[model samples]
Target: MMLENSKYLFDRAQKFIPGGVNSPARAFKSVGGTPVFFDKAKGSILTDVDGKDYIDYVGSWGPMILGHAYEPVIKAVQETAAHSTSFGAPTEIEVEMAELVKRMVPGVDKIRMVNSGTEACMSAIRVARGYTGRDKIIKFEGNYHGHGDSFLIKAGSGALTLGSPSSPGVTKGTAKDTLVADYNDLHSVKELLNTHKDEVAAIIVEPVAGNMGCIPPAPGFLNGLRDLCDAHDTVLIFDEVMTGFRVAKGGAQERYGVTTDLVTYGKIIGAGLPVGAFGGKKAVMDVVSPVGPVYQAGTLSGNPLAMAAGFALLSELQDKPVHYDQLEEKTTYLFNGLKKVFDKWDVPVHINRVGSMISVFFTDEEVVNYQTANTTDKELFRDFFHEMLQRGIYLPPSPFESWFLANSLTQDMIDKTVAAADKSIEAALESSKVDSK
Candidate 1:
């Protein structure tokens, strides 16, 4: 692929934008290279600024489940935008969106829209605090609930990619109230709850750990949390920002059959637009805003364009319901194919997947949490990433992030990606050997 255009764009981008990208992970600091500048995308392929075509696995970080340039979503956005974008007030579409979400997701009695996942999560925690009248929140390590101040400690994805889990600006007072627990370990949670007693307001977690690369809940883990929360009168908040609707039509809560007091969702609900939401039982959500004292407000909370696009995408899913099966089949096919390729190369890689979310860790150890996830051979992963990029396979830029598979990915693309992986693994091994010397 030609890189002249991409290189030029990145150079210009760095002069104005910190780290040459708006998102920290986009800087490719974890992989050590220039990020590809995409010009357009359709179905499963991304066309970069250099005019090179590549299979997309990132799926715009989990909202492009239907694929890029999806006609229905585009048309909906265009039509809705014609009647003014922001009202700073409620619209019927907002009600329609909430009703559709209620229809698809059985437990949510009411939902409030926000501009991004960060807002959804931050708002949910405040609601929890207000409703429970407690001062602390327990968050699982490596389970990123956006960059909210309380969530920055031991955060995953962008934070981990930059080699810093805790950021500098977060205050010591804020950090004190945010308790960190180990993912998949019920004992650590028990210890925290025991230590905090009635002081903990909520236990927020990513039902399927995506930030540290697609680690699913261990058997009975989520249920255990529910029990613990119930016993302690603590609210359980599901940060389904990445897994919502992608894993299932109703999100992980429906898939796992584990109910939570509140749930936070991200880009998937907006059909890849800038939107998010946090809602669950009316009892808890009533604590937020006009109903109660806990304050939360946004200028573009229910922007018509986002509401229209989300309704279109979600209605399609609710009607067909076959997209989930297709997504599962394709994701499993790619996972198995890539597994065979890695096995053939004698590489010690551990791959984890739940529904369409998956990741490849360079270590042989099962990546159940942050500690095991860190054991991955990042140097080898960097080499493998570049090699795969060279072969027109656009993976997530960092090892710590999950690779979101889209339903638009066809069998042919999967086969091509598997074929590319064989050569990429070989080249990566060679590069690793040279690096050692």
Candidate 2:
């Protein structure tokens, strides 16, 4: 629990690296603390710079599904690196990876590899616009599809209106092309579609929302989107960067039984490496360059190292369906344990989960969308987060991100986590009472 070294690193990182962290969230601005710098991780245990070990639930934000330092993934990366990393052209592993994805995923007939989820999404939207000859797209609120300019948009005063740029760099022109809709609300989407008519080229969603704390699609929501897309002749894109292989072998589309026109993937595909892809119905993907007019290219698009690691990891998941089931069991154990603790404390919390992805919101209201998800008591969560960290349990630093459980977690580790939660809650509640006093 002694984070002296972490504190030192943070100070140095701030002077050299902006905010001492590459990512804004990692700066611990939300949770108000020093972010622990990790030295190494094995299985479910993370060894911080000071050598403090905590059971990991972040799972590198959802790519280390099988766990950190997993032999297969590590071995694949090492072996592939021996043959040199980037070819800048074509390789057999990339083809194997794409073929595997097409086989495992439901609707992907042809796929194109990209460097990151943002690239995949950006490319996909371009393709949708090219194919449909339209310039606008609709995206659900609170869905994080990376830092793509188009994705960084805020709802403009009301639903059924053009969005405004959330970030300073994004132009009004970019924002105007993106429309924001309410998650889990088909009425909002229908309203936008009606207003926009054939102007919208595509609709992108996070299928199982992770950014606004793991909100699942409402009943018939995905199907509703499917029908609407078909009716409008608009392409539907599921940004499965988080849910791709983590929810199920086939992802949210398979889990919900609703397929999309195009799907973008990241996270699990690279086995924690920086890789992403977009693919779906052959007719639509055929619009991309080398085959069609739409141009999307990356020098390191199919980096051999990432492809090798991804293929190795995905092949395991494909061969052993039990990994997903075991992950579900472990996640359920944690969820139920946390629920019991909260119930015993008479603390009303909203826990939304889809398969292994889950989030704990400090609110009694059902977290069906971003607005409801915002009702969470931030102070309470911040207190709980610090207490959990002190007790060797690492949760996502923010209340809005999902806690990804790795199957590497054992029953003992889970029990220990529950016990930690019990004590942590008691201490956190006491702190809250003192702060109020």
Top-scoring candidate (lDDT): 1
lDDT of 2 by residue, 287-315 (tens): 99989999999999988988999999999
List lDDT for all candidates, in order.
Answer: 0.92, 0.89
How do the predictions measure up, each by TM-score?
0.99, 0.97
Give per-residue CA lDDT, model 1, range 130-195, as digits (tens): 999999999988889988899999999899888999999999999999999999999999999999
Determine which window of 10 residues in candidate 1 has minimal summed lDDT.
Answer: 25-34
Distance from true position, residue 341, model 2, in Å? 0.2
Best by TM-score: 1
Name the lDDT value of residue 312 in candidate 1: 94
- Span of ten consecutive residues with least summed lDDT in model 2: 156-165
- Steric clashes per prediction: 0, 2
